[model samples]
Target: MTDDAMLTSKHALVTGGGTGIGLAIARALANEGAKVTITGRGQDVLDAVSGAGIHGAAMDVRDEASVNDTVANAISARGPVQICVPNAGIAEGHSVHKTNLSFWRNIMATNLDGAFLTIKACLPGMRDTDWGRVIAISSIAGLRGLPGAAAYSASKHGLIGLIRSLSEEYMGQPYTFNALCPGYVDTPIVDRNQDTIAQRTGMTKENARQLMIDANRHKRLIDADEVAAAALWLVGPGSHSINGQAIQIAGGQTA
Candidate 1:
């Protein structure tokens, strides 16, 4: 296909596509002519975003059965999934002293295990095709430790590790695997985090929010489309050789 319709016959599956960064990427892929299946646990949220070239499915990435069933349904509806974005994840900051097994498990389940399941289910279809892309939405914490967010940081770190291993596993193949590590994106997750930060640190909500904004090198939250733009680049032209990379979206050096 031409660059104008590079994804004309492709099918893309994005988890947590109902809102935030995932939704932005779904829209971007659809805009490029790929049939997109945006999945979330809430059917209403998914349906609300379904239109144009984007469809919605209710699937919990934490469940193996749900992941498999949802991927099957997407294939039945839009053909093989040439693009997969495991963008669904939860972000919360907790000190190591306060982190428990349940908290650790939950973060790992949604962020790490979820990516594993999503990629495992989608790889077969991708392997059958001539070209495919797997883009995992990791975080800046994955590369550097974020104060008071030990569990969240660990989960994201594991995600990048998974992406790196897969990229090597398929080194000579047509499929490419990469992770996006963005700092303090402007999303619903950030809104919730601000509230948590306020409660935990006794800062006002606005101050808590500003804390994240200040974390970025540019002193602002990153737009969701900026992350989507990176994903589009990985799946778009000139990306075949850009595998196994953690593309940082922060304004400047994080470490």
Candidate 2:
């Protein structure tokens, strides 16, 4: 296949694809000729973004039935989903001492459990195909501690663990499993987090936002398209050997 039609016969499913990085990745895949299904909790948001080869499905990854039904419907409409992006997640900072069970479980349900359910639901169809990719949108916190966000860090860490183990399990198969660990991406999540950080630390919203930017090694927020480029590379030609890896898109060393 040529660069422009690399995914001509493929069907891709992206969770939380209404906006931000997920939307960016979905658009990139659709542009490359993949029939992309963008799923989110809101039908209107997904419908508004749907166009060309892009389709929309309302799905809540936190629920197993929702994941299964959405994936099945997407497969029926666009053929088996050869590309799966478990990109739906929640990011928040809470000191371990102050993090209650509700906060911790909610984070886990959305970030960790959601990835697990999405992958499990999509894998059977992927295995039926000759080419497949599972890209989990993780975070730098998965690689190391994120200070006050202990629960969020642990959920992301678990997500990476799931991807690693799945990669190992299907090592000899055509399928590839990997996680994209990005730091402070320029997304709506960052905007909401600015307010949270400002309230929590008594810093101005601008300072709070800049603090996250400064957290990146290159001292800037990573762009959504940059992460989408990495996803395209992973699913395209010459990436068969790149399995079980946590590719960091943090602009520099995150260790």
Candidate 3:
């Protein structure tokens, strides 16, 4: 199939699709002719990016009722969701000593619980179809412990575990489950992290940002589109055997 028609009739639901990696992936799917429903907490943000085969739905991933209702509405409008991308998450860093129970729960609720709810809501529709893809946006922290980010790292690690188990559960089926572990992507999240790091470490914002850039072997921050390209590839042809994997998109080896 032509690139523009590869996802022609498929419906894709991307949470946290208003900005950054989620937005990039949503746009990529839409360009390939998927009816994309991009959800976020901000209605205006979603509206700004709506159209051109992409629709918008304001939903909070942390809220179970909102996730189920919004997903059902999306399915009713656009048909079964063949592609589910759970990318909504917070990337805050705090040492384990400083992290409170509430803070840790918030991280898990948005990052891990959110993915579980999204996949659960969309899986039935996907199962009714002949093919399905559940691509969870994990982090490099998921593969390795990130210093001073115990809660965030744990949430991402849980996400990868969930994806891996699902992949095993549905082995040999037309559906595939995988997680994308990206490192230091140049997105709004990184920008926020830079500021946070600066305040926490008493360094200039530039130095804080440089710290992330240096983390990558390429010595530069990864573009959001680079991660988006990986998502597109997973949904594209010849990716059937790529299931149950934690594909890393760091500039080089993370281990």
Worst 10 residues of 1 by lDDT: 1-10
lDDT of 1 by residue, 16-116 (tens): 99999999999999989999999999999999989989999999999999999999999998999999999999998778999899998999999999999
lDDT per residue (tens digit) for residues 57-171 in model 2? 9999889999999999999998998899999999988888999999999999999999999989888898887888999999999999999999999999999999999999998
Colliding pairs, model 2: none
Off by over 4 Å in 2: 1-4
Off by over 4 Å in 1: 1-4
Candidate that would win on lDDT: 3
lDDT of 2: 0.93
Give me the runs in candidate 3 sitting further than 4 Å from their true place.
1-4
Residue 44 local lDDT, model 3: 100
| Candidate 2: 10-residue stretch with minimal lDDT | 1-10
TM-score for each of the candidates: 0.98, 0.97, 0.98
lDDT of 3 by residue, 1-255 (tens): 365598999999999999999999999999888999999999999999898988999999999999999999999999999999999999999999999999999999999999999999999997898999999999999999999999999999999999999999999999999999999998999999999999999999999999999998889999999999999999999989999999999988996
**Alpha carbon lDDT at 54, candidate 3:** 88
Q: After superposition, how far is residue 31 of candidate 1 from its true place, in Å?
A: 0.4
